[model samples]
Target: MDDTFPKIEVLINNLYDLKQKRDGNFEASVKRVLNMLMVLEKGLWRTTRGNPSSFTDSQVEKCSLQLWNWAVAENTLSTISDIDNAKFRHVACKLLTLSDPSSINERRVRLQIEMCLNAAQAWIVCGRYEMTDDLFELARTCIEKLLDGLAGQHHSLSGSKRMMLDRDLFSIDGLQFQCVGSLGEHDKAVIAFNCVRDKLALHPKEAPFLAMVCYNLALKFHKEGKLEECTYWLRQSYDTGKAEEEYKVDSCQQAKTLRFLAHVCLQWEAPHCWINALNAIELAIKEQPNVPGFLLYMKILTLSEAPDTDLISAVQKILKHNLPSDLVFNAVRMVMQNGRESACKTCLPFVCESLSHTTCGLEVILLKMEVALHFGNEDEAKKEAEDLIAKHHSGKMLKEMQQEHMHLLLWGRASFHIEAKCYADALVWYELSASFYAPGKLDCNLAKLYRNLATCYLELHRLNKAKESLSKAHRIEPDNPTTIFLNLRVALFEGDEQNASHAMDCLVQLANQEKDSVGRLESLPAEDQETPC
Candidate 1:
């Protein structure tokens, strides 16, 4: 026997004696065993076996099983603190040795894995990511072993043990989904997502888990550019999760899915899809009414090709709810988009008041710039922009604060120049805008900037430079009709009949695809108005 075997036997006997005495020394005995377990856990990291008492692979397995048996007999284990209760410590020690396969047997491995699965769940409940990852690996190994055993025709496990194995398999599958999602392995992520869905199908009562799987599948589909499939799963997630108040599903999740759906719709130029996004926002509000949802909904409604009057009522409701400064700022954007300048003016004071009450000082300055520009008060806009620049340059803001504030300042200046038709000045401001972290990878905005630059060059009759800017815009967005039209004009003016003919053919094809009266009329030449393209 190993030297540590003698010490282990002594500790086991002492623990049994303490249990028998029942002298209110239970806590002390548990702590001692916990300390000993900690020592053995640390030993897994050591390269040298210090003495005969040091636990070998077989002895560790034997002790872990004996410890579980003792815990079953004592019924004393309550928490990880009750290590002397044996079961908890044995599982904990086995988890520590999972990377060292030599220290665990098949049966002990299965028990240890079950215990680690429980521990991992507990850690998840506590929001401990590091511990959750450790326990998750142990659980995964256990489930993989069980799968292998089943494949080899091991004796069929019964009842709770079989259920436990199934649950562990599901959890491991969920973990794999998270791992693949984090690594951006969207293909593998989708496969794992389907596996989870299949697992959940076997147990339909697990609504929360099913919702999570659906949510993940939606995200993976979105990444893969499968818009219809993405929408389907997103709706499934929202529908499944919305039924459970106990889960307290985050409204942000629903809101994000809605927002992404709206974005995909916009990309596809599908007006009906935007209505679906609006519906989703309403559903999200029904689940958990909040300012962010209102803000997102308002933005979507404002951008809809056919704005609904009900959206206006919704905005009024949002304002009545007293949304935060940022949300109110978005409300201002919606109003501006709807050409409700007076409504924007009315909301200005409330926006300023909310900003003053918050610690986000620079945001207030930025909002002032926005309101000024919206109201055609260029002087006020420039003043706010200069003030913000001075404040940031004087080290009066945090690094993050400065970075955020500078972008607003630059954008305000850019908008001012663009509206004033001072395209040279606009180019300078846009160059500055390029230096900031774009909030949404706004390639559309960049494309617009290039288009504007191209227009300015065209005005100056610099056809080469105009072509260069238009090429940049086209590279960013190949199918934008406006860019195509502009490029066609450039070709015509440059007398490149071949290029002009090609651009016209593309425009005619797009016009035919639209199947609208205006599109057909636009495609016809001035003298050929009676003829179709």
Candidate 2:
């Protein structure tokens, strides 16, 4: 018997009594806790020597929990706070060694894993986003060690044991990726993701696990802005997850994956995002009808500028859900840009009610601007725009959306002016819009901006400026019929007959291309007054 066991027991007894006091002397208590862990480390090794009496597994579990509590406590002693984190892995690794051999009892091995996992979870709950990576790393090391040892023992294990092992391994691998991603180590996260992917490959029959692996990878890459890879993995996760009893995966997980895939498609401007999202949500709703899933479906359905199918059924479904006021208001805002008077009117009452509430006031206000423009209520639209400017606070989401709103409102005013035949006013507004939204930037309707600016200049008889705007618009969307037609007009105005004839011939060919796309024009201006056609 190890003679040191007696001294260790005495140390633990004294430390346990001191900890039970929960005295205000946090530094003194942490120092005592460190002493206890140092003594417990020796005791953990004794369990490997077939000495069951040397240390109870419960003692290790309790110590692990105590250390976790100390680490995350808001008022933890600063001097010893980091000590608690450093000591955790030592105790966990010591316990891992105890669970090493098959000679160790199954109950003891399971207890050690559970204790380590609890410790890992504490790191997540207690550590700030920047500090949790080390916590997950400590937890992952223990799990990986366990998996490595268990792989050799798998042949003798029962089916249930195999499943438990697989699940634990899968969970830890996923947690590691999530933690790595949170730390913004994209390369490291991909390594962890690949590890999970390779593990899933080993068990090809586990569709749910496969989906989970893909789902996590998709999410990580999506957050990293690797959109192509994100889309690929999202499609894999969604497709595989939709296969069996609808993947027999968690309903929320299924819904989230499908929603993410739809979002990915939307980000890529894929033609099938809406249809696939609608179908996926329908299936997901049947399994577990969640508001987020439904709300996401509504976003896709209503926000579509040119949906291939009627969205009335989808919108009605949302109304039938009798969702919370916040969600209903949000849905109304999404459909506000649909440019359909009837649809916008259907949501008008809730939108007005939403404007009365505080949550998302800016978003609701901006949507009101768009909705007003949809109805050609220029005065109301102008009021909402001014209101948004008054209430605008600086934030990333708000700033981006605010810029978009300003651009569209400016465009709306220009269109209204053109429709009203106020040529000089149209020219002023269109020129301001073209300057605010430069032609070469992504996420701006630059082609239309330039084309319409050309139109405004032409109306004002600024033939040279009209030709310049038309040339810029042509470079962006070379084959756009509106751009080509305007190019012909600019050439004719400048008496460049050869260029006018070429522009006319190109316009005819593009008209054929436009006809081939029948009912699928990707670049139709939101307001019809954008072009002479």
Candidate 3:
């Protein structure tokens, strides 16, 4: 209803209904549904100034009421138990497929693999192992494709997607050190749990995930009232988390462990666990109370209904210190959480300076760009981008990284122009950005990007360019009415009666499809309440 993905939502609904029926080949329908979900996911997740409001499940949902009814029964979403007992799981397995890559986009391939992994995981959680092997195979294929993207001979290690694949150059005292970024971890774990029973002891390298797994197991035990086991595993998890810092290996996100520890202390009722969790986070205050990691912990504590006096003191301490940029940014997130966004905006300068220097740092700088766009600071954003490009073109980051980064930077700059209604400038930036996409790799933004280009060209009276861009968009997403309508505009602008007539005919056919879908929904029994317009 918020119109986050208005045009695609309609297509998604139609596909949702088709997939749920007792007729036709469900495999095709399921793939269609998954493909649409993947597209919608990417479209809605673009950068925003502050917190992204479009990220919530309800805001970017996959299932419609008329289809995937299993997902709608419970607030947490339908589980295995929610599946219709009447239907055979083999039948369900036939329908729940690993969708093929809709486009050659690296992100799209990643999403395809993720979709399979997610489906396999849900089935696993529901004790449905029948389909995991097939599902895992699908995930494995995508990962291979992902590696191919990373391994292209011409693609230097500097590219953003490939950057994570680079082995960081750090070592100490006869031991190699590195950051974590493995796509195979999920399928490997699933296979190990399913088939490999006599595996070796947990590897030292896997300690981070071990801690996470143990902590989650502890929560499960706690729910089952097995307090002793719960407490033991929680301690193990906490100890492992503590080791992460000393080890200097990037297993978990910064401040995640402390936040988790604090969450348990505040949310769990058990006094023993509470004390341990509280103590763990409180100890962090001694290390760097003015740092982002510590301030984040303090922010977590402040969320408590009955925050301790010391917790309140920690927050005050953060304010008194001339903190580092990252800490100030963390403070901004905290301040914003308390409904003080204006105060956070005032702290953006510090946030911009906090970006790490080791990597291409495009993502970090993009955050600043987004905030600038949000606050309507065009000059500041433009200046920031210019300085970044200066550093990039000067070989601060590799040319390959600069090349990949240029696309995202262009897209960000285009967004700024769009906001100001500078259509010509926006079109140029988008065209440049779209050119930088990896050859053969599908860009999720392809359709929308060209569609915008078409609009911009039209505004400038460049009818030929507008028609060409719209045609390209049509090739990417042929069925989308939004693209079709814009294509109609191009045709009309050129006074091409044939193309205009064709576009209008297509629109009518699409409208009829929707009308027919509605009629079917209306005919269903009133109790189903399954239709979603």
Two-way TM-score contest, 2 vs 3, winner? 2
lDDT of 1 by residue, 113-194 (tens): 7666655544444334344565677677767766666656765667777787787677777765655544455567668777
Scored by Cα lDDT, where does model 2 land?
Answer: 0.61
| Prediction 1 TM-score vs. true | 0.39
TM-score of each: 0.39, 0.43, 0.35
lDDT of 1 at 310: 57
Pairs with backbone N, CA or C atoms under 3 Å apart (clashes), candidate 3: 104-441, 104-442, 105-441, 105-442
Clashes of each: 4, 1, 4
lDDT of 3 by residue, 1-533 (tens): 24545544565466556545736665455455455655554444343223334433332323222223433332143322423211222222222231222224555454444455445555544544454556556555666666765566454344654433221100110011110101213334334322211221222344565456556655665667655555555665556545534443243332444544555554566555565555656654543343644664655554542234444344445546645544544554455455433544554444445345535255456545545544556676666666655555565653554455445656766766676778777765675556544445444366677777777788788888888877787787888776777777778888889999998888778879776643443353311111101
The per-residue C-alpha lDDT of model 2 at residue 484 equals 71
The stretch of ten residues in a row with the least summed lDDT in candidate 2 is 518-527
| C-alpha lDDT of all candidate models, in order | 0.61, 0.61, 0.50
Report the backbone clash tally of model 1: 4
Q: Which ten contiguous residues of candidate 1 have the minimum total lDDT? A: 524-533
lDDT of 3 at 474: 79
- Cand. 3 TM to true fold: 0.35
lDDT of 3 at 137: 61
